[model samples]
Target: MYAVFKRELFSLLNSLMAYITIGVFLLALGLLLWFFPDTSILDYGYAELTGFFSLAPFLFMFLIPAITMRSFAEERREGTYILLATRPLTDWQIILAKYLACLVLVLFSLIPTLIYYYSISELGLPKGNIDTGAVIGSYIGLLLLGSAFTAVGVFASSVTKNQVIAFAISVFICFIVYTGFDAMSQIFALQYLESLLIGLSVNEHYQSISRGVLDTRDLVYFISFVALFLGLTRFVIGGRKW
Candidate 1:
């Protein structure tokens, strides 16, 4: 598992894909937080990262798929998947290793944005009137959200040998999981059903934590979501060899 993890990480860093994904994330973050003047701008009286975190999910919908698109799809396309399958690693190990690699890459891209916190602090009216607790909570929610999306992408990649199809499917699935539930709630007739639908959405839980609530239910929802997708990915890959 460790060897596979290292190899996956090394391959991602060695490729242009990693750089391009990170570059796009940073560019979007900068534009939304700094360049685009709106209510959340530094000079607009909003010291918190409300706008930044709000934009994170949409950006990650594309970025996470880009990172995970080639995880297994490209290997299968190149016929290296057979070689990997013959190795001593179990399907779960392989999936976990690849998932960890993608998670690390996503987290690495996020670390640089911490500078935005300091920038806002220095520029605030009272030298840091920003809601630190909410910022931290939002970052945690963003990480969990990204992890779930990565798992979904990995599962999508495992189902197909074509990277383009994997990317498309991953993006579509992530979009659905992230926002589909809320949309469904609007169309539901029963109030109970509508409430349940909204509760199932990634965005709902994300918004709860983003407000600095740190609800145990929200944390569990994210963990369960990621685990469910990762388990499905392992099952899919294992069945392929049977």
Candidate 2:
């Protein structure tokens, strides 16, 4: 697992793909937060980074799938998955290594965004008037959300040999898991069922956590969501295809 993790991380860093992915992520966020008209932070006339947190999950919907689409898809396409499976490593370990690799890249992409927080702090009328606790909570929420997306992407890749198909399927799955539950709740006629459905959505838990409260249930839900996909990836990789 460690060897695979190192190799995957090395491959991501050694190529221009890593730079491009991070660059695009940062650029899109930057433009929306600071440059674009109407939606720009400057126009909003507020020192808080509420806009960033609000838009990040949507941006991640595309960016994360791009990063993980090749996790297993490329290996299978290039016949490296056979070589990888020949090693003594278990299927879950392999899935985890790739998942962590993509997660590291996601974290790296997020690091630069701290500048947004700092900038907002300084721009405030009282200087450093930002909601530090909420900001921290939102960051944690974003990480949890990103981890779930990464796992889903890994599972999508594990089930297919085509990166494009992997990406599309991941985006669709991520979209559904992220928002489908809430949509279902709205459609359901029973209030009790609606409440249950809402609780199942990632956005529901994420928003709850983003309010500077660390609920164990929210954390557990996120972890279980990630684990579910990783487990599915392992099951898929354990098949004859490997």
Best by lDDT: 2
State the lDDT of candidate 1 residue by residue for 1-102, as single tens digits.
999999999999999988988898899879887877763476567677788888889999999999999999999889998998899988888999999999
TM-score, predicted candidate 2 vs. hidden true structure: 0.96
Model 1, TM vs. native: 0.96
Give the 10-residue window scoring lowest on summed lDDT in candidate 1: 37-46
Which pairs, if any, clash in model 1? none
Please, what is the TM-score per model?
A: 0.96, 0.96
Runs of candidate 2 with Cα error greater than 4 angstroms are 188-192
The whole-model C-alpha lDDT of candidate 1 against the native structure comes to 0.90
